[model samples]
Target: MLPISKPDLDAETVYTTCTATARPKSVRPQLQQLTVDLNDAVARYDTAAAGEGLHTLGDLQHQPDGKPDKQPGIKKPKPKAGGLNTHLEAAYTNRLVPEKSPGHGFYEQLMAKAPDGRCPLCSQGVADTLDHQLPKVVYPLLAVAPVNLVPACRDCNFHKGDQAPAAAADQTLHPYYDHNVHDYTWLVARIIEPPKPSITFHVEPPPDMPPTLAARVRLHFTTLKIARLYNPQAGPAVRTLSLNLRRWKLPSSQVPQHLLELAEDAAVENPNCWQAALYTALASNAWYTQGGYEKPWR
Candidate 1:
């Protein structure tokens, strides 16, 4: 996962803005009544998230069909049509996500936070949609909470589904709060040899890192299937690097040094990106540097 600056928005502000133009006039007042409780929930969520305790805050249990087994803290509205859940979800889908909605600016602002529109979750896919860090279905009070909303690619969003963590270590790295993960060189790749020479990415948390933090990194990597998402790109990158090396036609002894330079440059650009990991692995592989890159290793 990649780090991003936390949004400058709050729950009460976003909820009130979204509710201002809530449709079905009857639901407007009901949504309005939830402002205080929703804001409280957001505050608690923020606290728990900072402390990595979000799993403890939600009293609702996950159901097989993505329904919340219970709605705690926030009371259901008078509307029988799914009550507070529907209103809050509509508050997001209708009021916040629509192009001309009052909260569209906030939506854009949140999307803009992702560096170059790349999903922080995968750091590769384009971040076009907002994903609820804690799924809105299970935590309706945070349906429109800006802090709870993260810029994500459609694939990562779909993969995440409506799941919430059952424990602190189970939680995926939060881009805003999990900045420390980026400070280390955990994302690494290994060069697989012949029959089909390809690169595969994996996480290797620093030796001195806390065990729980290390586990969280592994969980984030696995949950998002980072290896599966990165390997295909790594293959193309390996071929491209080989092509470039051939074009340069450097001496065999110089190839590893040239590749190391490329790895250093990629690391400078993005410490944990697939390119950096791939190059680092290739640079260390004597076979690849010593005339092996000339072969068709795609």
Candidate 2:
């Protein structure tokens, strides 16, 4: 996954700034009181997070399904500030996700820092929502913590859910901290011979990476259905390229040049992008470049 820079803004700052906005006369004072309590709750989390990190609040004891149980004595600050939890929960779960609100909403600021607004997890979709690095229910205070919030497409966020890895190998790459994963040649595709040629995708971790990290890469791909999702896209893509070669009546030697262009174009967006890997795989294989692509279309 391509890493994104953590926003300089944190949850507390966002809460204060958001509530300080112009409000209707009816609910203005009430909303201001709730913001105070919400800020206090965030301050408590900040103190607790001083040394252990934000994820420190989520229980390390994971269920068999890989979701960690919420820690005990999980404090939900129930101050007399009437709408505190209401707004706090709403902000964490829903209010912060939409980009329509303009300049300073959490989602907008986060998206501003994204890599061309592409989902880092898939690199194919828009990073439309904020994904909590740790489940918000478990670490409610870190719900808005800058480093803990990631901009992601709905698909990647949904697939990840509240699950934490049961082991190091099960850990999905955290785009912010795991930037190196994108540098490697991980995603790859190959033509599968059959009634018609089609491509299938999978992780092909390089040999030098540690076994654990490699397993993590494979696990990330498997859990996210990277291969399952990417394979379908590859088929139509290969077909299009195959047809183009025929339509243009390109010379055999020039096929590599065209495929290389395809690969390079994809690489410009992400060196390890699926299309780059897919095109590179096709171009590298002698059978495909030598006209294996034309069989299915013609």
Candidate 3:
């Protein structure tokens, strides 16, 4: 995934202040009461996992005894029909999808100045979904923390559900936090024809890189299931995003002229090394042959 800069948080602060001011003193206690109830509910749902292993609110709700009950988790709060309460509803709705929600137009305006008018993860052609770096489920206080919020494709979001605390030596690369991960490139692609219509890609480590980096790469690949595209649920997206597509298309006839030019140029500059390393690498894939151009080579 491409890296993303953190979004501006000024708007969130403004919203919070406005929300507090708009609430009448008479209703403040009621709001606090509701907040307390919500926190209690959250605590109950959260406590079920204390040494109990794999317990979920759903499991509690659907126990074999067939008695549905309210677990400790907080119930959704009811907003008052009008006035200040409606403003509170608007505040939350604004935060739901900061980019598109009109109530949070300030956030959208700030995001518009981002490099691609989208979150890095979203712009990377992955599913667009808001992700909380520190899971909101566990760290309720960070639920609206601007720095903690990130744009993520649906796949990444689903995979990361509720799991925070990055693994030791994880190379999965946080789009916002990790800055030194761009050196390695793990491209995956499959050939469709010729000597062997098979996938061929390389996981290249930077020259003299440390073992931790290699470990991180391995962890990322396995966690993300980057290489196991054959799995029924794992095919399309990751493969498309990670692999160089041109190499999978095949024969010179299918290759683009620009790519052929690039191959020739690289070969000319570093003939032996380019042919053996670069050309051989591209020649091994069908998609690479099909494109014959490399925007990333530079």
Highest TM-score scorer: 1
Weakest 10 consecutive residues, lDDT, candidate 3?
61-70
Off by over 4 Å in 2: 15-91, 94-104
Model 2 poorest 10 in a row by lDDT: 60-69
Off by over 4 Å in 1: 60-82
Give the Cα lDDT of each candidate.
Answer: 0.81, 0.63, 0.42
- State candidate 2's TM-score: 0.72
Task: Give a tens-digit lDDT track for model 2, residues 1-298.
Answer: 7767646775556755444432333434655555454455455534433322333333422311133233355754432333333343444554455444322466667776668887777666688877776666544434555666777889888988876544556567666666666666777777666566677777888888767667768877876667776766887788888888889988878888789899989987677777998888888878788877678732
Write model 3 residue lDDT over 1-298, tens digit each, in one string.
Answer: 4455645554335345334433345654443434443344334433432212112333322221223222246564444433333434434444445554543554443344334544343232343555655455444433444454566556656666665443345324455554345544333333334333333333455566566656655555455544443222222322442254445544456444434454557444233221223334455555545442332221
> What is the Cα root-mean-square deviation between model 2 and the actual structure?
6.7
TM per candidate: 0.88, 0.72, 0.48
Query: TM-score for model 1?
Result: 0.88
* lDDT value, residue 50 of candidate 2: 36
Better of 1 and 3 by TM-score: 1
For model 2, what is the C-alpha lDDT against the true structure?
0.63
Runs of candidate 3 with Cα error greater than 4 angstroms are 11-103, 109-119, 122-127, 188-207, 210-280, 283-298
